[model samples]
Target: MTLIDPRNRYPRPPFKTQPQDFPGLSANMGPEPDYGLDSYQSGERLKGLVALITGGDSGIGRAVAIAYAKEGADIALAYLDAEEKDAQNIASSIEAIGRRCLLLPGDIRKKTVCVDWIDETVKKLGGIDILVNNAAFQHPRKDLLDIEDEEWRCHFDTNIHGMFYLTKAALPHLKPGASIINTSSVNTRTPMSILIPYSMTKAAIANFTVSLAGSLVEKGIRVNSVLPGPIWTPFIATGMPAEQHESFGSQAPMGRPGQPAELAGAYVYLADPNNTYTTGALLPVHGGMPQL
Candidate 1:
């Protein structure tokens, strides 16, 4: 599960710069941003593929869905009913790319709903080729004791339990060369101070992705995870406490947060057939977090 190899190494950037000087100057005279949004363009990597993305309504999920559509995949978006406006915007964007987009509103926390989602997607889209389990909910807590039983259960149901349900439901429809990409967070690698329960769910995703990759590889399904560091998304703005939200991803070596567009390439790479040999991997999209 560990991809970091100490024996093989790469150059480390100087760490003594001020926060304002972050993102750093490139080898050329120009300065580079923390994450390269301009460089994260897509080819027709997923042409003819059909992808289902939970949380496809907004944030990184929205970016991935749009990127996949631009790459030539028809999309099925599953999101909570509360995200109607955002979901509609994503669907419109997808359609603008000349790809078909189906928006399904439901609570993924229920097993029945998960099953229904896959069944409906297959019926609407013909078959499922890529499954992206990316919906999650996290509430910041001052202490573990401050977390209510309902909140803990909600985290488990939305983050881990729903992922299990949807993956199981979609398995029969997914064929060889299909990919299942889960969204685990950097919290799994470096646990956050105030996100105890949420961090636990993310860690579970990392373990589950590895376990599922092993179990499904014989069937030729590729399973992997993307552990994002601190991306600036509506999830942070709305999901976390208003006060703590300001400092969301500032502590990373990159100093500033990432944009949604920066994450699109990683998803495109993993979903593409070119990455056939890679599976059971946790690709860190964190801003140069030191690997242990």
Candidate 2:
């Protein structure tokens, strides 16, 4: 029998830059990420539902938005204003799939914006049944000095606090049998020194999911979190240092980074109507990464 080597998966020394900024574009990656168009058999698991997803413009969020649409759900996608191009791409794809798309562009870090967007989504979509708190911001700094006060605050603001703002505003409108899926990270399990603030925020997210799940489940609104490994998204190429980019996800046990499309199924599974018993769980889609 022949043996296979794990390191061969998407060999590093990556080819991507032009947009050397945070939340990189998928179009520029070496092997363009699979957004499930060529895969993901759909059975309309979420038929006739409406979802509000933050960070639905790119990466995992983008994949989830498209998958939800294919599963027969109308979507209200909230993304940063700067990600207009990526957001438009998602919107077009969703619309093409015969699902309605309401694109809301704003910063979730602002409480008023998050609250206002939820109102707009409810008004346009008629009601909210699924909420994907997926938008996040992270900056890796090797030294403490490199992490400024504002950067630290931004991490909590965008990661955890923004989640609170959006979740609180959307809570009352969420009907029975609803689902709330929060996008967390593997960093919560194994904290990265450079990403201390990001790790703290992720830990808080897990706690929030479990605690909130308890309070909401009785009302028929379930809550869960997805703990993902190093997914090959623009979030890395743009936020990480140039030299580090090539070796971005090589540290995972699988010896490679995951693609955004790979994580879509977990979100879909959690949102499925049949998943009435699954809540307060942190589902990890990290290729061989230890969640505990």
Candidate with top lDDT is: 2
Cα deviation of 110, candidate 2, in Å: 0.8
lDDT of 2 at 160: 88
TM-score of each: 0.86, 0.93
Each prediction's RMSD over C-alphas, in Å, is 8.2, 3.0
Candidate 2 clashes between residue pairs 3 or more apart in a chain or in different chains: 21-238, 24-234
Per-residue lDDT of 39-115 in model 2, one digit per residue for the tens? 55688999999999999988889889889999999999999988899889989999999999999999999999999
Summarize candidate 1's per-residue lDDT along 57-89 as a digit string, tens digits.
777888889889888899999998877877887
> Model 1, residue 36: what's the lDDT?
25
